[model samples]
Target: MSPGPGADSAPAPKPHDDDHTSGTAPGDGPAGRGTFSSLGIRNYRLFFTGAIVSNTGTWMARITQDWLVLTLTGSAAAVGITTALQFLPMLLFGLYGGVIADRCPKRLLLLFSQGALGLCGLTLAVLTLSGEVRVWHVYLVAFLLGMVTVVDNPTRQSFVSEMVGPEQLRNAVSLNSANFQSARLVGPAVAGVLITAVGSGWAFLLNGLSFLAPIIGLLLMRPAELHRTEPVPRGKGQLKEGLKYVAGRPELIWPIVLVGFVGTFAFNFPIWLTAFADKVFHAGAGTYGLLNTLIAAGSLAGALLAARRGSSRLRMLLGAAALLGVLEIAAALAPSFWLFAALLVAIGMVGLTVNVTANSSVQMATDPAMRGRVMSLYMMVFVGGTPLGAPVVGWLTDHYGVRVGMATGGAVAVIAAVVIGLILLRAGGMRLKLDLRRGHRHVRMVPRERLTAVV
Candidate 1:
């Protein structure tokens, strides 16, 4: 993978072609390599430090926003609407956002997007503080934020490779998730206290101020050290070309399809958790925050474990997703609050595993030239499906019990994992095998030819 046309500006080393090997110097042994190895790079360290602060504020805003919407309308369905508005742009213009990401400098795009996101938060903060806020005002700000995220999400994802290069990409991606989940552990707890004491306005104000850290970090980065890719020139048919490229690769395509299914139906936690906290348990905002914090604890553990691994596997993605579904079902049926809370931790761990595995696998399989567009489609299917799924989940929670709504989501995840797993196996010219003998491999996917020869 040599640098394409127009990449001459940056004189950094080219990214390695291999995905599994770390491309380290001979003297750099195991001691120099591990989960935190990518943080050794100065630029990534700055980015990581700034990102943790911004991510914490983002999480606080999320908790505060959901609670505010719930308090205003007193309907679970309204919270779904707010979530939907915030993600609607991704569903509609996600591909175009990818095209823009490929054409523009990712760092610049992130700066502009982050600033716009901060403005949205500040606007909401002002309205709420002045006692002029209405439900529609929140909806409008959410939609504006989504418009910015249409460009921000893919840009931020593709930027990781530029900072860490190929060998350390998987580790960096896993660490990024760990950073978010770590913030998640604190954000909701803080939001709960603020909402109870000062009010949601203060949370929004803090979130608006948080974007400055990332902006300053970006300015401090060294341009010559970045592994820059040539920006895709403006041209016709590029979007279609990106789509066809993904369509041809089973390794890239199948994992994405599986995530799309799971993300769409099973990942409606905003709706389910809020409903359970309010309706089922008769608890207040503190309980909702506690549920989120528990999930975050498990997610942080899952992300740390992922960072320690050397590679991502499709099998791991499938297994984790299946486990996520089973855990969700169990949590949905728990008879007591303590039991349900305990299950949430396990569910969070498996859910994060599924996310990290799929994300790294897809990025590893993609070409640098096509990464922006590929990641855009990846994010589109993953987060974009929220608009369609959230309202339905909210309605179900409103009409049927929260238990039924959550269990249904779990059922969808289980069915999707089984179906996609079988498809991937068959596509690879393999078949599932079962053996019952002691000390034997009981279940696995064997090559079709190997099974035929055994028969």
Candidate 2:
């Protein structure tokens, strides 16, 4: 998920679902309470803490779901197909989801979505525990879960600003990433142990039960603390107007493009890991979980860094993208299991840096009126890119070998850096070059007129 970007001095609402009230007040921020400490706010604190607990279960369920499918089917293709099904709805419904989010009461909408997710988790647990589960059952459940996510993602994103206001929006978003990534770390490891001990069914049950936290958080929040908006317009112009607004700004457009490219192409750690543990290393589920753990650990650290640096910078984001590519290649060449895990940690750190940074930049830069639509675009590419890349990546692993497949993605990422950097430069009305000879990469983001006149 992307954090809303920019607006450093004031925490302002992003384009919100008109129903949310971003309740900013006199001297609200200077009291050391809004942005950095919005978590300290009465309403947001409850919601944030609740989110942390809920997110852990969500990650746990995802890990178990993938593992369960793989264990029963023993087919990588099945995993890929199911993963594709889970995300395909995002690609198809993202725009519509944005529309729904922009028009609905985000809190109320989230209540329903979270409940659906819990029920989905419970149903999966029951079916799987019964030992009557089949491949199709997993697929159907995954598809339903994906459908719920289509409704859930934008609403949840748009809801944060309502609770914390725009002053603390960046921090709230960063903390949210931190929360999700922290959950990512706990969920997978716990799922691994549980799957190896009690069974995957229990993990699903835990996830189902976890939804209660967020549901309660929603019920407890004070609407007076939220940013208020006029009634939602059902105008046919909503989508078109939002797209036009997004297309018009360089601050916003560049970051969205950056995230779209990187998210679609580079941040595919899960599918790539399957190849690492199974094909290249010829290992099993334990090794797979360990690899994910290493990556999640790195990502958790990256989230922390982003949380501290609440401002957005395009140069920083691009630099992270470049570093992420370099690490991908390094991970591919890791000589042993332990070394590979170490490299994966580095890969995860840099990958999350790319992810969190790009996400923060795009979300912050977008217009408040169109945040839902813009975020949907961000997520649509981030998740949608998987369906396109996974099958191809899986095929490459199957045919060309895992090392080559991993290397291929890394190489593409590197090429993307050079290409995207130039694209951003040219689009920014500037020409730039990167120098790495001084034992560090130094890039100067000079203006177009200055660079052109120099030549």
Candidate 3:
């Protein structure tokens, strides 16, 4: 189950690595720690450029949507419902989505998904601009958008191989995380200003426009240069097979399990943040922008830190989870909005670090042929837990208060980390060995206990 370590390959920037048509250079080349080059293919530059533009816009839409709902009805439960509708499809159809991902052309799938998402954005924009937006309309659109995301995420993940080839895959995944986090920094602030100025509706309109970047990249990509996975026709046992493949690997299992809990609990920061600003923080939309920007500032640092460590190790992942847990706890207890925002910066940094580590580690360890299935499982756990867990947090916030709900979530995250650390060390037959003399290269190895799901 433990795919081999990706230590031999340095993650690189896409543009730098793509031009070398010759096969991988044998070991002595200076390895990159954090750029688009990891995949040895340079074209990821185009991919990265497009993604950077798109992701920031997406974040803007998300914050605006949440803020709008809070404005319209003042119902936290409704926000929970909106969030749940968006994510519930992943729990229901994510595995099948994975099966399709392994078989589909990722670029084409992305095109269709992006198109659908853009249309939804446009619809939302029109509704908002007309001053006719309704809670029910938002709910329905959220569900539709979620459906598109279910298709988009898996295809996008599996497509990484095509952009950079197998050699730079680990680095590619890590760098991509950095890109996503980087966009996180800019997007919220922009959305905050726009929301407060023109209104939340304009933010949606802009998101619709941002889709152009990726569409352009896709169109411009040289078809002949791509590394495509062969399509697999649907069969009776495909979904089960993908599940069995995941069930077999402890390296994969523990990371996904940990992320499921942590991502689910910690990611509700958006909901908690709006509450904090309105309730405890007593800030307006502008402060909401600052809060988000501050967190992204921490995340940008985290993504950069992750980029340095050449390999994704179990120890780094666990450490991040544990640190983030502490920060989240502090955030919930903060006496002032400024203090809470400061805590959020640290929370975001550690959160992104853990996320990138887990995401890169799992992607690197999975078989190329089964990569889609594994990545789908990873996404499903990370996002699926949101629908399941967010509602509970929302309910807690609605009744007990945002602080209580967030604190509980942080506590749960800490417990999840502790448990995962134990499982990896004991039952998973992993040993912790740290090499501080060098950068943090410590790792857990489980060759003997590894599970093979190909059968």
Candidate 4:
């Protein structure tokens, strides 16, 4: 999931400890409570804690789901199909989800969607526990979960601003990434143990139970403390308006487009990891879990850095994307399992940097009124691409080889970075330059007019 970016409002300074209430006073601007500034806001703290619990379960369920499908069917393609079905709703209905997000109260929407997702988890748990679970059953449950996520993702994303406000928006977003990554670190290890000890069914059940924390947190929040924005009015063509809004901003649209490529192709980590573990490395569930844990460790580090950095920038987002692309290629060519695992850490860091920066930048560039729609679009382009890309990558891994699939994704990501970078330079009216000064070479991207005059 992505975070919203820069703001039209200047970020108010960190709030004083002496002036603090249960949270900030109304209209006082967003307060960075401390380094963990967003936590200073009571509402945000509740949301944060609940989110971490839920994210752990979410990650556990993801690993279990893929592993279960592979165990049941003994086919990587089956896992791919499950993955595609899980994200297909985001591709098909993500825009409508965004439209609904704009029109509804996000907290209320989250409560309903979270419950629906829990029910899906419970159902899958029951079916699997019965030993009657089928590939079709997994497929159906995955599709249903995806349907809920279509609404849940954008609502949850847009809700962060209301909890922490614009002042801590970037910090809150980075912390959210950190929170999710932390869950990723813990979830898989636990799931691996559970699967080895008892079964995947228990992992699903735990996930179902995990949703309760967030629901309770949402209920306990003081609604009045929320930094609320007006919901978009019900009207036709609002979707088109959101589309036009993104289309008008080169900075926003280009990163989004780049993410679409990366998300579709490069971000299929679960598939890649699973293939490497089961096939390439001839490893078991334990090794698979370790690989995920390493990536999450790197992701946590990246998220923390992003939080301390305090702002999202366009240049950094692009640079991260390019670096991530290069890292993926290196990992693809890695000869040993340990080397590949090590590369995953760098992959996780660069990948999370790209995600956090792009998410923050998009949110910052958007109008509060239009945030839900824009974020939905951002999610749509980034996550929705998975439905299209996963199965193809899976097929390539199954038939050609895992390295081939990995290389394909990396190559596509690198191409996307170069193309998007060129587009940004052209839009900014600048050109790349290489010069040698005092025997030390420097490459500078300079204005087209300056280059012409110098010539």
Candidate 5:
């Protein structure tokens, strides 16, 4: 569930005076509102709108990029390599990016990072359009994109608190996921059509141009309305400070650890889906795109449901993760394409529940002054683990067959969820309780002391 009020050592940062203009003052506006309440804030509304366009483009690029790698090499491992290259920088330098985000103006940092990201996309587009693109060229651009993401991801993540304040942070985070998943529903379908009709290059070109929407949105934001935090002054050992902070808090540490396991071992969908499309189903890029769209549909639904919820619970997080693993395993063994595809939708829903719950819970538990570094470490473990997982999953798919690879990932997720859940229970002096009586709650976690007293 929720962490205690004083979970972090640092005092919570006060909202800027201009935050009142954004309509997020205590007991007013979005404060005690419903699912779409965060959108009532003008600044967040702009950020959300721009994100819709940019995120759609991002999904398009991702689909096109993976397909291009598959087309160029015809090797699943190569696709894994592309994925790995894209996230490797986060593994190496993610904490440092958090430090930068904490020390700088987030809006300014976002401007530069977003511009650099657009440039990276444009460069890739030029290469593809000019017929000069090679696998190495794609790899180069992916790495550069990742370098920017090391800073961009943390800045963007922590910026939500400023836009909406703590009152609406979870709502905004859920809506952000919803926005991305909604784009997922559209981007792949469009990419499929483009790849089939025009070419992957045009998809790449469109993705490059899509960044302009977000850039323009950033410029239009009212800086005075933001709930700004005092930036952490530059200093040595700040990374270590962040690390130590997380280490001491079970609420922050366990969620990050669980997500790390799931992210690294279970979230290799690109590799798994591509292999299933080409090898198992004997299908083409369109099938790949369709499968992605199905997942997005489920994820969007999950995100919307999460937005309506009042709080994030660790029990829900663990249950969703375990369900995701089970669904993945079932999908791996499905005898028909339709059955497998159906399982993917369920997988997407549970997977997103796992993500949104962990993200919101962690953010709610963290101190604002430390959010950048905390979120950076969060993103690093979550996304950075990809480099380690993708190649291994790819190799497994290549040698052991797609079913084995998929099932193995699911098994790892299930194991991680169980292990981490148990660890948390033990640390909290609680135990799982099963009640097999009518008109009673069937299963729950109860404090050991309570159980002893009852006995």
Candidate 6:
């Protein structure tokens, strides 16, 4: 049923090439390496280290950018617009960017993309430090950086298997999430202090400098050690081919749809959190940073837990999404700031569960030849909806108040989870039943093929 793109067009892979499986079990070569197995590979180690530096800088920039936008305009809608601009390019070119990743040398492409991103950061830094930064300046740089990310995001995702073969891909993906979460924990706290002590300019400048670590790491990677796949040859209708490829697979399409809904409506944390800090809590940047750090703390734990698991399953994904939605709703109704913050930790954990499971499932289910395209489609839908949703969510928060805004996202998420879950259940030819016998009650979804219905 995995009707992927034309695998016949792809050349036979080398012996050292990746095995196209969802990386659940440990690979024979690295069975002894344990949970940190991906780090044992020299190339993955280099990439991982570099990623840590860059991701930290990215988080710093994110906090600074949102705060700066608010400071300049005093409008949540303006902040939302900034977020929208950053992701708008991905909505436009993300699929095409995946095609480019498949056709080009990923390592080389990353070098250029990373360099461009750093330059954008630096330009923003200079403008801010000189007191010449305007709202347009922020908007322009966000869009430019996002344009570069259109290329960078999918390439980086597909590049993981190159650094660590498919056997370790699941572990690698989990570790990568952990790394990013780790950065989330540190970057926001640091950005807060720096913003208070100096200004947003220094945070931008440091992030610009952080790019050098990845650039240097890329240069240091051993080309021969990489488990490289041959680039897809240039051909007409490749993008169409990718769409058709995903369309044929239920496993691929379902998660993407589920994530698309969650990402669009529920993942507007920047808008939600900032409004809470400014409006509800009536706090400063430090409190906002604290809010971020708590979520990151929970997310970090969730990532570690995911790393411990050998496989990501569909049940995990659905359950996590449902839990996340419920928690989000609960958080929205919190009577106090501390209660809301505590709920954030649980929200972070459930959110990561959905993310890690969906990501691992898609990558594992996809064929090697079509990994880039599938992942690009994954990124496009999963992230692309942000541009369309952020502004709307921002407007809601601006007019209806933070609680209503949060509640709106929460309600949408819960509905999406229930709808997607029912669709998947029926697709599996099953129906849920509630049974009460001997004063005990239970509920379950039974397979239609196995059931005898009483008339």
List TM-scores for all candidates, in order.
0.93, 0.88, 0.87, 0.92, 0.93, 0.92
Alpha carbon lDDT of residue 37, candidate 3? 56
Can you write out model 3's per-residue Cα lDDT over 110-211, one digit (the tens) per residue? 788888888999999999999999999899898888888777887888787667665566667767888887888888889988987899889999999889
Worst 10 residues of 6 by lDDT: 14-23
**Model 6 Cα shift for residue 20 (angstroms):** 19
Q: Model 2 misses residue 337 by how many Å?
A: 1.3
Residue-by-residue lDDT tens digits, candidate 5, 99-186: 9988888888888888888888888888988988899999999999999999999999988988887778888999999999999999
When 2 and 5 are scored with TM-score, the better candidate is 5
Q: After superposition, how far is residue 409 of candidate 6 from its true place, in Å?
A: 1.0
**lDDT winner between candidates 3 and 5:** 5
Please write out the lDDT profile of model 2 over residues 1-455, one tens digit for every residue. 11222232232333222111111111123332333466777877887788888888988887787777667776566667778788888888877888787777677788899999999989988987888888898889988888888878877776666666555666677777777888888888888788888988898899999999998988887766666433246888887776787777655566666666666667666667766777678876666777788888888887777666645556666677778777777777778878878888788777777776666566655545566777777777778766777667666766776676677778777777677667766765666646555664465555656553322
- Which is the better candidate, 1 or 4, if ranked by lDDT? 1
Q: In lDDT terms, how accurate is model 5?
A: 0.85
Clashes of 4: 7
Which lDDT tens digits does candidate 4 get at residues 303-415? 98888765566667778888898899899999998899899999999999999888877776677778788899999999999999999998998998889888899989889
Give the TM-score comparing model 1 with the true structure, all chains together.
0.93
RMSD of each: 4.2, 6.0, 8.1, 6.5, 6.1, 5.0
Query: Which portions of model 2 miss their true places by more than 4 Å?
Result: 1-36, 433-443, 452-455
1-455 in candidate 1: lDDT tens per residue? 11233353332232233321122211122331488989998888888998998899999999999999999999999999999999999999998898988888888888888888889889999999999999999999999999999999999898887887777888888999999999999999999999999999999999999989888888788766777878888999999999998898777787788898899889999889899999999999999999999999999999999888776777788888888999999999999999999999999999999999889878877777888899999999999998998898889889998998899889888999888888877776678778767887877667777773322
lDDT of 5 at 177: 95
Show model 6 residue runs off by greater than 4 Å.
1-33, 438-441, 452-455
